[model samples]
Target chain A: MIVFEDVSHDYGGGPLFRDVSVRLEQGSFHFLTGPSGAGKSTFLKLCYGELLPSSGKVTLLNRDLREMTRDQLAETRERIGVVHQDCQFLDHLTVEQNVGLPLTATDRPLRESDVSDLLGWVGLGARADALPPTLSGGERQRAALARAIIGAPNVLLADEPTGNLDWEMSQRLMMLLIELNRMGTAVLIATHDLNLIRFAKAQVQARVMRISGRKLQLAGAEL
Target chain B: MSARAISSLVVPGRGQSVWLVTLSSAAMAFLAVFALALSVTSARLAATWSDALAQTATVRISAPPEEMDSQTALVLDVLRTTPGIAEARVMVPEEQAALLEAWLGPDLPLDALPLPRLIELTETAEGPDRQGLRLRLAAEAPAAVYDDHTRWRRPLVQAATRLQSFALVSLVLIGAVTAAMIALAASAALSSNGQVIRVLRLVGARDRFIALAFVRRISRRALYGSAAGTAVAMLALLALPQAGSAVPVLAGLGFQGWTWALPLTIPPLTAILAWAASMATAFRVLRGVT
Candidate 1:
């Protein structure tokens, strides 16, 4: 689980986001929505220890982000899988290798058969041998999702996981995210797509949190 | 980390700096082997040439052919009475001829030229007092001058000693150059793979884990390069012919049976140098970025 307490971040010019506290509990599905440049990606980065908060505290898996050593941060990352908006990957490697990267980093010896099964579950079994640049946008999103969950992390943070996909492909990716949440993995997805949030809410009992006026606020039922 | 995990960390043979580490390591190894060879040869030459030239004092009695015999006899008599003069005797014509045979032709007649009569003096445990012996010879055989061979031989020994020092310095410089080159290469590789490293860090790869990939990649290539250099150096050393050579410098180029193993240390030493360079560079760069 990850907890944020009055965390504020500034990118030199001024504070892009301010004093906002939130907690992501276990086995919960939440969707983070905000306008462009609303610090949604930055917030996700704070949860994963990629960037330190300007003030206040952020804790991941009970360890304070400000105090965690590099090794401890790495260990926390092993427990938290993240899907970037851009679906970053080592382009030279095959899709299977990219997906297995999480397991490799954690020294978790995953069998090839199990890796194949995971790819199949993500509908990427046939694209295993292809490189990231060669894959379609939808396939890349699925590949990123598969890679994020390969280590079976306790929490998953997805930043615009379906941003580049069509409605059909987005629905397919949402179904995969819903299935992961059902299996007791805490999921928080930050997106600007309102329809995507409504679609996801219908599939799973999901709470929606929106970033407004530089603070996190739970949306009302009317939103 | 498991071998599989470590192997997965690097894209095999994909780094652009691979050639830099390999070539630098090879260059360092080759220089190291030559340095070792030079040091060994210097030690042997210093011991042999220094000791040979140390305990020798020759008294050359130069005069007219008629007076040469009397002066030589008097110089020998004076040297025998002097303390620390172990055994003083007139050098044979053939021995004197042998000394000048290379500069002067072998067939040159010693009697025709007005050459000096040389008295070879071997020293006791405590060598003769030069000033006292010189005074006695001046009174008895004033034409005679004592030559200890120290002027020419001391420089030879000193030169060899200096050469040994130079070789040691060269070996150290080679290690430093290799480290510097590898560090530059490691930094370049890190900068180029910034995205890959970010992905790796996000997926739970520690700095040490990321560093291990670069270290092993650079070091393994260095090991191969150093091995090749050692093989080439061994062949080069063996190619220098030492058969029946009168020149001590040429003869000393090749090492003895067991001493030949000295050059073998270069490859492993270079491997360690590469490991250290890459590891340090990786950690420093990682700290800067992550």
Candidate 2:
């Protein structure tokens, strides 16, 4: 679980967000909706310990963000899966190798069958040997998801996971995320699409938070 | 897994190309062996040449031609009785002519030339005191002047000393150059694989683990390269045609006895150099990353 208690972040000389706080517990689904440049990606980066908060407490598990050593932060990242908007993949690697990257990075043992199983689960089995440069947008998203979940992490963070997907493909991805939430993983999806959030609300008990004027607030009952 | 075994897994092509390490190792080994040979030869030459030159004295009796033989006899008698004067053999005309022929070539007629009657006085250690003998000879034979070979001995000893120092300096420069080249190569390889590093770090890999891969590869390559160079160098030195009995200088230029063991140290030295350079670059790059 990730907890942000009065956490503040900034860039250069000015503050991006101040005294912002929220707790993400297990088995919960939350959507972070913000206008352009509202620090949604920065917040996701904070969740993964990639960026440090300028002031106040941002705790992932039991460790404070500012105090964790580089090694310790890397260990923390293993338990928290992050999906970038661009889904950064080593273009030289095949889709299967890209999906199994988490295991390789951790020096974990993997059977040949585990790769095929993971690829099939993400619906990328047939494209396993294909390179990342050859994959379509939705396929790349799912590949990124498989890589994130390969370590069986406790928390999942996606920054615009469906940004480039069509409505049907985005819906399919949302269903997959809902299934993961049902399996007890905390999921936080950051996006700008209010319509997507409204649509997701019909199928699950999800809360929507909007960032405006550099403040985070739960959307009104209508949202 | 042990670092060595793990490292062997990553070298692009190892063991298959015998000449890969061979060329560098042979060149380094050859240079190292020559360095050792030069040092030893110059050292021994200085000691032996100085000892021989230091022991003898030459008396130039500049008396009239009528008094030259008497003065020479008087100087010889004085030397015989002096302490530390083992023996003083006056050079015969033929012997003096042979010595002069070395410089003037055989064409100079030594008998026709009024070369002063040179009396070579060979001294012994404990035979005669050099200073006391010189004073006594001057009194007994006023025109007899003693030259104890010190004029030539000092310069010869100094020249040998300089040669030895030059050999040692060359060895040091070679080692320093080798170390610097290896460091640059390691840095280039580190930069080339920078993306691989970022990927590994993102996946939770420690810096030490990542550095081990590079350190192991480079050190092993250096060791192998140095070994081949050393072998070829040794073989080349052995294959050189032996100089015939005439020139003792060439005889003094080779390694002898246990001195051959010196070149064997070069490969390990190269390995240590590569190891230090690779580790330093790895740490610097890792610091930049985190």
Candidate 3:
């Protein structure tokens, strides 16, 4: 679980967002929607302890982010999965290798069968040995999703997960996220695509929060 | 994949930095071998000179031809009474001629000239007091001079000791340069592979895991490179002309007996240095990231 209490962040010029108080509970599904350059990605970064809030506290998994050591932060990250819009991957690694990285990085035994099944679930079974550079955009995103969930993190934070995908691929990726949420993993996705939000909202009980006027605002039922 | 395999895959394997570390380690290791050889050889030379000259002294009797034999006899008598003098013998004309043969060619005639008589003395472990013996020789044979070879031994030993120290300092400098090169290579590798690091970090990998990815690969390369360099240097040393009394010190620059095993340690030491250098660079670079 991630809780930001009255957090305000700035980058010298002015605050990107102010007084943003929010809590992402277990098994909850949420969408962070705002215009481009509206601090959605910054919110996701703050949730994962990658960036510190200028004012106020951000607690991750019941511990204050400011007090955690580097190793402790890394340990905490093992329980929080993240997917980026660009689908960051070690291009030299094969798809299956990248997917198994979470387990391997943590010194856990990597089950080949589990990795294979996860690849199958993500529709990347045929491309398990294929390198990331050789994969299509949609395949890359799906592989990224597989990698993020391989360790069974408690919360999933995604920044513009479907920003580069086609509508059909976007829906497909959303369905994957929904399926993951149904299995009890909390998911918070940041995006500017309203149709994707409505599509996901109809499928799961997802609340929509927007960043506007340098503050966090909960969008009403009209969203 | 195994943890090691996964770690290796996390970083791109080909880059200028890889070759930089390998080649620098190899070059530095090669120089280190020669430096080690120089150190060992000089140390041996120092000990040999000290031991060989410490227990011997020579008495030279410079007098008119009529009194040369009597003065030499008097010097011998003084040496006989010396407590630590084990053996004292007047050198035969042929032996004296042989000693001077290198400086004065073999064709030179010696019987017509008034050559000084020489008496070589071998001392016991507890040698006689040099000052007391010299005073006795000065009294009994006014033309007799006692020479302990201290003037020659002191300078030769000092030169060898200084050479050994120089070699040791060279080895230390070589190690430092090798470490610096490896660290620079590691920093370049980390900088060039920023994307890989970001991806690894995003996937919940700890700094240790990420650092191991680079450190293992770099250190292994260093080990291989230094091993090759050490092997080549040893082979080159073996191909040198065999050391002998006639050979110059430079020509005889190599290990002796068990000292040959010293250069073998260079490769592993280089690997350890590479590991430490790259690990430090990795952690420092990572600190700037998150």
Candidate 4:
């Protein structure tokens, strides 16, 4: 679970957002939407302790983000999966190796069968031996998702995960996230795609929050 | 995959830094072997000089030809009664001529020259009291001067000792330079692989895991490079001219007996140094990230 109370953030040019408060409870699904450069990515970063709130406290998994040591932050991150917009990967590594990193990086036992199964589920089973440079954008996003959830994290935070995908590919990726959410993994996704939000709303009980006028507010019932 | 396998995969190994660390370690290790050889050789030389001169003395009698025989007899009598003197004898004219042959040439007419009478003395382990013997010789025959070889031994030993110190200081400087080069290479490698580090961190990889990746690669390269360097240096040393060479120091420049094993330690020591330098740099650079 992640909680932000009376949080305000600034980048040395006035506040981007002020007096914002929100709590993500256990096994809940949520969507964050805003226009370009409206602090959607920054909001996701704050959720994962990548940045500290400028004016208020940010708590991750019941521990104060500011109080965690570098080591402790790493340990906390092991339980939280994060998918980025760029779908970062060690380009030299094979897709299977990249996907298995979450387990291997933490020194956890990795069963090859599990990795293969995850790859199959992400539609990348045939591309497992291919390097990142050879993969298409949709394949890269799927590989990133596979990597994020391979650790069986308790919470998943994704920033514009489907930004580079086509409509069909985006739907497929969103369905994978919905399946993960159904299995009791808290999911918070930040995006500007209203169509994706509407599509996700039909399948799960997802609360939608919008960032506007430098504040976070629940979307109207019309959404 | 094992942890080690994972670590290797996380960091890309292709870069100029790799070759940089390997070549620098090899070059430094080559120098280290020579420095080690010099240190061990000088120490042995110092000991040899000290021991060879320690238990001996010479008595030189310079007097008018008429009194030379009588004064030599008096000096011999004094030496015979000395408690710690094991043996003493007057040098035969032929022996005196042989000693001067190096400087005076082989065909010099020794019989026509006015040469001093020399007596060589060998002492027991607990040698004679030098001061007491000098006073006795001065009293019995003022022209007979007792030389304990201390003047010759002291300066030779001091020079060898200083040579050994210089060699040791050279070894220290080599290690320092090796560490510095490895650190610079590690920093460059880390900076070049910044995106790799970011990806690893995002997946919950700890700094220790990331550091181990670079440390293991760099240290292994150092080990391999230094091993090759040591092998080449050892072969080079074995090819050097041995005893009876024109240069006295060169005669004993290489290792002797059990000391042949000393140069073998250089490669491992360099690897450890590389491990420490790269590990420190990895952690410092990682701290700058999230």
Clashes of 2: 13
What tens-digit string does per-residue lDDT give for candidate 3 at A68-149?
Answer: 9888888899999998878888888899999998889878789999999989987789999999999988888888888888
lDDT per residue (tens digit) for residues B1-290 in model 3: 78777887788889999999889988998999999999998999899999999999999899998988788778878888889999998889999899889899998888877888888999999999999998998889999999999999999999999999999999999999999999999999999999988887877788999999999999999999999889989998888776774666567789989999999999999999999999999999999877
Clashing residue pairs, candidate 1?
Answer: none
Report the C-alpha lDDT of model 2 over B1-290, residue by residue, as the tens digit.
23333333332333322233334444665687688778877898799889998877778877777888888788777777777766677778888878888899988867677677777666666546667777887789888787888889888889989999999998887777666666666676667666656655655556776677777777777788888777777777666554454554465466668877877888888788778877887777776774
lDDT winner: 4
DockQ of 3: 0.76
Best by DockQ: 4
Candidate 2 lDDT at B207 equals: 70
Q: Please state the error at residue A212 of candidate 3 in Å.
A: 1.9
Ranking by lDDT: 4, 3, 1, 2
Q: Tell me which of candidates 1 and 4 scores higher on DockQ.
A: 4
Ranking by DockQ: 4, 3, 1, 2
Candidate 4 regions exceeding 4 Å error are B246-249
Indicate the TM-score of model 4. 0.96
DockQ class, candidate 4: high
Which of 1 and 2 is the better model by TM-score? Answer: 1
User: For model 4, which pairs clash?
Assistant: none
Could you arrange the candidates by TM-score from highest to lowest?
Answer: 4, 3, 1, 2
Candidate 2: deviation at residue A120, Å?
4.7
Candidate 3 at B131: error in angstroms? 2.5
Model 2 chain A weakest lDDT span, ten residues long:
A103-112
Grade the docking of candidate 1: medium
